[model samples]
Target: MMISALPPGLPHPPQETERLKSAAEQLETSFLAQMLKSAGVGEMPEGFGGGIGEEQFASFLRREQAREMAQVGGIGLAQSLFEAMRERHDV
Candidate 1:
């Protein structure tokens, strides 16, 4: 049988590929969280339930929500990022 040669620095090990995928997802999650925070999704008007405490913890909520969204196939950003990295690294 003939063996095919991989391009230099391309095609990481399975574990490394998994790590890259996780990192891409995390990056996407962070981006989504920032977008959600900027859109004021977790904000509340004055005299409502939101206050200093809520503001302080709003980021955490946004991050969790973003993570869930990414896990559930969010905005295709993660996939795009993963594919780009794979191509760049020749993986």
Candidate 2:
């Protein structure tokens, strides 16, 4: 099998916050934001997964937003922000 090389400075997965941030910035991708949205992953109430009765989910989002903001000096936008850093940097 032939090996395929990746682009310079682009790891399969980010290895640090700075790297991830830089990649997102350079590629105009919102990986961090998308990841943040995914981490709040949870199933909605039965029969309401795709229904209009997502009040509980909405409430959860609100609380999560407040917590994130408070943690990041009002700039924390998503749990993924912190989670990504922790994962990439092991910090």
lDDT winner: 1
Residue pairs with backbone atoms closer than 3 Å in model 2 (clashes): none
For residues 1-91, write the lDDT of model 1, one tens digit per residue: 4324358666678875796689889999999999999899788776787667888788889999999999999999999998887676662
Clashes of 2: 0
TM-score of each: 0.80, 0.25
Error of 1 at 31 (Å): 0.9
Assess candidate 2 and give its TM-score to the true structure: 0.25
> How much is 64 displaced in model 1, in angstroms?
0.3
Cα lDDT tens digits, model 2, 1-91, are 5334455455455444555554434222233334445665444666657654474665556556544544444444334455464455432
Error of 1 at 73 (Å): 0.7
Residue-level error in angstroms, candidate 1, position 6 = 5.2
Clashes of each: 0, 0
In model 1, which regions exceed 4 Å deviation?
1-11
Specify the highest-TM-score model's number: 1
Clashing pairs in 1: none
Q: Show model 2 residue runs off by greater than 4 Å.
A: 1-52, 75-91
lDDT of each: 0.84, 0.47
